[model samples]
Target: MKKQIENRSDLQLLVRTFYAKIRADQEIGFFFNETITDWEEHLEKLTDFWDMNVFGTKNYHGNPIIAHNAVDKQFDQQITSNIFGIWLNHWFATIDELFEGENAEILKRRAQKMSTFLFMNIFESRGKV
Candidate 1:
């Protein structure tokens, strides 16, 4: 019996579950596993981010664009759409495994949009286009 993502606890579950796959994935795990030193703190921040994203709260203030750009530079711009694709795949799989209903669907759509937007920005930040 899955449920809607109606609260912070749910978002926490979603973020934690989704990131587990990301951290374990062979193709993209190194990007996160190496960069994020504090899993507990990072998970809390990500929970806050999803809370603000889904619930219109203001608990999250970190700039994803800057963060991602720095990651790209740190890895010599190795980040690619295939990596984002893997990320999205994990996100969608995690959501489907945990919950259902409008919030579940909304998270999928949001992830899709964010991946595209982030990749574009990452590409532009590389100064290649």
Candidate 2:
């Protein structure tokens, strides 16, 4: 059996793996590929975000809705549920591949909720486009 995610290091690894899959994906890779000039910094920020969610750490403080809204405008594409679904798929797949336990289960649930919330925010902002 795979080890459960148990620390910041595991969170970092998970985020890195998810991003690696996303950066190569055909459906939504353009947004990340064109926007992220610094993969290391972005990955660090994502690690912090996941840490905050998974471990109750307060290291992340950015507004995901605003950031994604800006990216949507920059790319002239609406962020849709399909895109979020792709992202969630990669996220859960990474978690399942790496770990299995309470933390992994919680991460999948949290990611699903987060994706829904983000998609709602993104979908609501579609009127501006």
Candidate 3:
């Protein structure tokens, strides 16, 4: 039986596993390939982010929208809705593999909301407003 994400370790595992897939993906990998020189630090930040998201821990503080906007500028706003779909697919698959419970479900739902919010900011930046 899969366990519900109940602590920081689980969040770390999920963040790491999810990013490993992202780093290997041919399409969305480039967004992170060159920019994130410190993979360990990046993973730590992501762990904190997910930890806060899933567990309501207050350890993460960063403007994700600003960060993704920079990424969009780097690739000329190529992070389309389809790319976000791929990201969410990987996230759901990772969560399903390691977790099964209300918190796990919350993780996916929060990710969906986050993706939409971030993408909307990106679209606005591209004059799609």
Candidate 4:
């Protein structure tokens, strides 16, 4: 029986770890640099997003497509793909590091599904596939 993560603090740590990886990665760091005006607020919003998604907290209501579309409008497909890939990679890595049992598996599956959806959206938007 693995311990269940039942609070926002655990989720915040996961988000922070994911962003640390994003900041360190050369290929995707520029996206963070260009898009995030206030890093702390961005992290908080992201933590809230995950809290809502993973914990059903109902704390996040931001439009993800609009935000990503804005960034996609600025950057090309390759950059977007790199960003998404690194984003999912770091996201799942953080989850795996900090969680266990069904919770970890759930996060991993959700991240993979989101990555696939983002890739398909990118491809469809570009009329590539």
Error of 2 at 116 (Å): 1.2
By summed lDDT, the worst window of 10 consecutive residues in model 3 runs over 50-59
- Badly placed stretches (over 4 Å) of model 3 are none
RMSD of each: 0.7, 1.5, 0.9, 2.3
Off by over 4 Å in 1: none
lDDT of 1 by residue, 33-105 (tens): 9999999999999998888778988989999999999999999999999999999999999999999999899
* Top TM-score prediction, candidate number: 1
Looking at candidate 1, the ten consecutive residues that score lowest on lDDT are 48-57
Specify the highest-lDDT model's number.
Answer: 1
Predicted structure 2: lDDT: 0.89
Local distance difference test, each candidate: 0.93, 0.89, 0.91, 0.76
| Better by lDDT, candidate 2 or 1 | 1
For candidate 4, lDDT tens digit of each residue in 66-86? 566567767875545666777
Q: By lDDT, highest first, what's the ranking?
A: 1, 3, 2, 4
The estimated TM-scores of all candidates read 0.97, 0.94, 0.96, 0.84
Q: What would the per-residue lDDT of candidate 2 be over residues 34-95, giving only the tens digit for each residue?
A: 99999999999999998988889998989998998788778766577888899999998999
